[model samples]
Structure formats: C-alpha cells, structure tokens
Target: MFNGLSAFPLTPMNETGVDEQAFTRLVENLVLANVSSIGALGSTGSYAYLSRTERQRVAQIAVECAGEIPVMVSIGAVRTRDVLDLAEDAQQVGVKALLLPPMSYQKLTDEDVYSLYQAVTSNISVPLCVYDNPGTTHFEFNDELHGRIAHLPWVGSIKIPGVSVVPDEAKARVDRLRAVIPKHVTIGVSGDTLAATGLNAGCEAWYSVMGGLFPNTAKIMTDTALTGNAAEATRLSRRLEPLWALFRDCGGSLRVIATAAELRQFTTTPSLPLPLRTFTGETRQRIAAVIDELELS
Candidate 1:
C-alpha cells in the first residue's frame, strides 16, 4: 500500500525526451533501498512541468521497472477530464495508486474538491490518495473539509505537510486530524522532521522526498521508529539531519532532489525547471561538507 516510506523520485528528462534510462536507474536504486513504494510525477518529479504524453510514458516505465513493487501516479490537472484521462492511463499501465492534489492557481470550495475526488473515484478503479499540500495547492483543508472528502469510498490516504507556520498550528492540526480521521484511512506526514512525531501521533506513513537521497538510511530510521525503538531511530534520524537540512533550505522539491543527486550522483545533471536556480555556490559547498561529514554517498 501507500502507507509506508514512499520514495518520490524526480522524473528524469533530457534533450531527447523523458529519459527512460535514468528513470529505470532511479527506480532500481529505490527498490534496492527497500522503499515500500514509489511515486512517479510527484512534486520532486516536477509533475506540473511534464507534458501529458510524457507523464503517461513515465508512469508506464515506472510500472515496468517496479515489476511487483507498487507505483503511485500523481494526477491532478485543471480540467477534470484531463485528470480522469491520466488516471485511466496510469491504471492501464498497472499503477497501484494515484495521488491527487486539489486544483491549483484557483479558488476551490470544499464542494469543488469533493466533486473532483468523486469524479476521479467514480472513473478510476485503483485507490485514490488526496494530498492536502496547502504549501503548494494554496487550499487550506481543515478537518471538516478532509473528513467530508475522506467519506468517498475510493479515498485511501491523505498527505499533509506539518510545519510551524503559525503558533503551534501544525501540531494542533495533526492532533485534530488524528482524532477525526477514521483509523482505517491512513494519514501520511510529508516533512522529514515531523515523521516520527506524526507517526507517534497516528500518521501511518511518511511521504519523503528526502528519502531519495539516503533511502537506506531512511529505511533504518522508519523501520526502527515504527517498532518503538526510539533511541536507534533518533540516532539514524540525527545522522540524516544534515542532508535533510540541505534539502529543507531550498526552493522546492526539485531543489531538494537536485541537491541530493549532486551528493549521491543519481544523475549527471541536477537541473530544475526555469525560474529556479541550480543552487548557490556557497550552499553547494556547505552541502558537500555535510555529505562528507555524514558520509551520505
């Protein structure tokens, strides 16, 4: 299922087209790291920047490479038709699940979000995971909104990013959600720092972009934490903190993945979409020091 450490890999592209070779390599590395699952076309994958056909091709390749491992396709577009189309494409390619965010760049009421989920569920057969990423989607989904949406039969999980934007707001929100959300439906915390706390508080899984950098380390941390081995988990978590910090101190998911790739040598070019720079020289130097200090590579 999606209820574990899901490594969201960056969708690799080069001058030719969607780089299937790199995509294959990334998937192979993640499976070897013992990741519970993989999500293609995620925030780290630059989902928004990819073309419709490219997204479909990447999804197919992910499924092919994963073989038995589950593959989650992040499908959220402006038009409901487009979303359905992508979902159908993914389902055809044997994707295990779909992760959808609310419509972006527009104001959507609770009803609007619900309707989108309903439309997706009615058409798509696989499980649907709703991502409540207000940081990017700009739609702050409170408990009531999420509760209503979760009632839909196909809804599987909710991905929430916990950060202290307001006074103790993140923890408060997590508490409320853990109380209200049905125990059957899983809640996955997105931030690395909050994973342990969220799991202790009721989060079933952690959707980690940081995991791509140090998947083996993350595997050790999550496995230990899940089993109540706090001391060992904390030790691994602290060891991973430096790499995580480098990613946190960045523009978005792409910057984080690029920085990690720079250290891990996952790809030759750690390029991000336009308007986002390739990280500063000072940041790069600091990241190198952190990687060397921690021996991340």
Candidate 2:
C-alpha cells in the first residue's frame, strides 16, 4: 500500500480557513489521475501552519475523498505526547498510515528520536513512515538509526529526502540508502526534482509535491523508471526541468506549486503564514510558461 507515487496535495487555503471545495477538488483530481496513494498534512500541506482542528478536518476530508486509495497523514509534532495524540486522531479519522518526522526546536540525539517513534508506535494501531527531512526537522538520520527504526513493529517505510542539490548525487544517495536500510522497509524519496533519479536508483516510492497537482505525469514517470524504460523516464523528467528550476530558484516547492495551482485556476492563491509568501510576478510568469510548455493545464 505504501509503495508507488504518494501524491501530497497542497492544502488550499483562504483568509477564512481551508477551502474545502478546492481541497476536495485537488484530492479528486489525484484519484482521477490514478495516483497510487494520497498524503495529507505533509510538508507541502503546511501541517505546521494549521491548528489542531484544521489538521483533523484536513485528514478526515482526505480519507473521505480518497476512497479506495490509502491516505497517509503527517502527525509530526515538537513533543512526543502531542505526536501520540495526533497519531490517535489520525487513526480515528480512518487514515491508513502516519508519517512522523522527528521535529525539534533544538537538536535531538539518536535516543531522543528513537523514543519518540517507539512511544507512538507502541500505542498506535496503524503503520508509520519515518520522515527524514533534515531541511525542515533539522534532524538527520544515520544508517544505524534507520535500521533501528525500520525494525519497529509499526514502521513501514522510511522517507529519505535527497540531500544533494544535484540530481545525480541525489540519485546516488537513494542508492546508498537502499543498500544500508533493511530490505523489508520501503525506501521512499521526497525531493520532487530528484524523483525520477531516485526511482531509477531503486527507491520504491515517491512522496511527491508535483504528483499532488500532476499525478498523471508523476505516475507515468514513476512507471517508466520502475519498468526500466530509462529513456522515457528521463524524457518525462526533462520536461519538468523548467518547473524544477523555478522551484529551486524560488526557495522551495510550497510557493511554486501554489502559484502553479493558482495559474491553473485550481484554487485562489494559497494563503500562507507570515515569513512565507507566494511567488513574484516574474516567477509566476516563468511558471506559467513552463506549465504551458508541458501542457499541464
């Protein structure tokens, strides 16, 4: 259930709150596109910016709309107790799995991280995916740590973010992780631009931002790579190069995806919190051009 393209839908927001209509439309679109699974309240979903009630609502909505497709919801929190509570909430809402990042305001030791997952897994009935996004969590995972976590009863997958900014090196990182981690545990990659590379390097699944809005394209790329159609996979990934460039230049994927969604008229410009804003006019124009070039609209 965890393996394959796990689409991370952007949480459509307005001044009032989450735009339920738009959010539903986004999930429905992924289902229509036939993505392997759906992920809500992920990094792309702006989980940290939302309230507890909002998160619950989002997870419920995702599960309701996803139907047969499994829904994995992020339940990362600064405190272990809070994480446990969120895990219970997610399970109650019918979420199939929980994605937990060892989030920390301060640096955490290996023991600290292990205990957090152990505590949640011991209590929760659902499977959990270890999200190792050092960029957001500021916590890194070593091979030994991954091995320990993978052996946990409830742990199903390990999401490893592409550490290298370069695509080739990022692909190498996926291969390295595959070699070190337990074979039973699926290795999922999160960097949108490095998805094809990661897949070609033996990563089992893609936790993708682009897949959220462009599931057909993402599925095609993943299938091609997994089937050993390297040429076609590379071709599909190259078509996304322009958008990927904009994603890198604009800081990250949250704003770039939101802007693209707005351009596609999928929703109103995503309402982000302070310290984060939508794209600039020039950036939007570039994104528009790429969208047109790829015929994504």
Candidate 3:
C-alpha cells in the first residue's frame, strides 16, 4: 500500500462548510482510478485550515468511500493532544494509516520533533507517514532526525520533499536517506513535478497532489517508471511541465489545483478555505488554456 502512488485529494469546501457531496466524488474517483492509497486531510486537503470536527468528518467520508483501498488521513495539528485525538478519530473510521508533520508556532529543535513522533507513535493503531513538507509547516527534517523518528514503532514511511531533478543526483539523495533510516520504512516523494525523477531514482512511493486531481495521468507515469521505462516516464512528466509552471507562477499548488478541480467540475468554484482565494482573471484563463492544450480532463 505504501509502495506506489498515494493520491492526496483536496477537501472541497463552500460558503457553508465541508462539501460532503463533492468530497465524496473526489474519493470515489481515486478508488476508481485504482490509486495505491488515498491520503485525506493532507496539505492538498487543506487540513490545517479546517476545524477538528470538519477534519473528523472528512476522514470518515474518505474511509467510507474508499472501501478496500487504503486510506491515510493526516493527523497534523498544533498540539500533541490534538494530534493524538485526531489519530484516534482517524483510526476509529478505519483509516489504514496516518500522515503527520511537526506543526509548531515556535521553531522546533530536532529533539522536539523526535519526541513528538515518539509520543504519537506510542499508542497509534495504524502505520504513520512522516509528512516532511517544509513549505507549509516550516519544520525541515534532516536525514538524522528522520532516522530517529523512523526508529519509533509504527513509523512505516517518510514522505520527503522534492529531490534534485537530475536522475543521478536524485538517486544519490534517495540512497543517502535509505542508508540512514530503517530498511522497513519506505521513502515517498511529495513534490508533484519531481515525482518521476524521485521514483525513477528508486523512491518507493509518490505521495502526489496532482495524482489526486488526475489519477489516470499519474497512474500512467507511475506505472511506466516502476516498470523500468525511465525515458517514457520522464517524457510523460515533462508533458505536464506547463501545469507545473502554473503552480510556480500562481503561488503554489493549492490555488492552481483548486482551479483545475473547479474546471474539471470535481468541486465547486472557489473551493479553498477562508482568506485563500482561487485564481481569477488572466491566471485562471492561462490555467484553463494549459488544461486544454494538455488535453487535461
């Protein structure tokens, strides 16, 4: 379950609250696409912006819709107590795993993060994936710190950030970390644009935001790479470079994906949470143009 494409869907919302119907459609689509697993309430899902009640509801919805497909729910919160509470909530809904990042207001030391993982892993019922998304949480995980956390029981995977795009460098990066962490714990790649590079470099999984939006496209690239056809996988990924460029120009993936989701009718327009606006005017036009040019559905 942790070894292949893990698609993370956006948690759709409207003026009222969680858009249960649309969220359901997203999860069902992933199930149909036959993704390796579904990661709910991930950064892609806007977990940090939601209230605890909303997060729990989303977790229940994901697991209920996923059926036999593994569901990994994010349990990252500001406080350890709330993270534990979320872990219990997710497990209660039968989520196969949990995704956690060291969310903190103050700068966290290596000891702080290691201890955080130790506390959460102590009583968790399912496997946990360490979400090392430095872009949002602002807490970076060094290889040594990841090794320390991976030593804890139930720490089954580490979701590292993007590696160098160059194949050899990317492989070296994965190999370096592979040496430090326990052999049983898998290393997954996060950055969507770098996924082909990461996986071709021998990373075990692709924890992908784009995969959530377009699972078939992701499945094709992932399948091709895993089969040892690196050139075709790189070709497939390069084909989406325009979409990735939009992500860079339009201020990260959240809004750009929200736009794509809206265009694709997977969610209502303006699906993002409060204060975070979706793209508009020229930017939206460009996104739509790229979508058409790439024949993205």
lDDT of each: 0.76, 0.86, 0.91
lDDT tens readout by residue for model 2, 107-177: 89999999998898899898889999998999988988888888888888999886464657866776676
Using TM-score, give the best candidate's number: 3
TM-score of 1: 0.91
Better of 2 and 3 by lDDT: 3
Sort by lDDT, best first: 3, 2, 1
Worst 10 residues of 1 by lDDT: 162-171
What's the ranking of the predictions by TM-score, best on top? 3, 2, 1
Cα lDDT tens digits, model 1, 158-231, are 88886443325655766687676666678887877656656545566778776755677666667777787766
- TM-score per prediction, in order, is 0.91, 0.94, 0.98
Residues 196-224, candidate 3, lDDT per residue (tens digit)? Answer: 99999998899999889889889899889
RMSD of each: 2.5, 1.8, 0.9
TM-score of 3: 0.98
Residue runs of model 1 more than 4 Å from their true location after superposition: 163-175
Q: Which is the leading candidate under lDDT?
A: 3
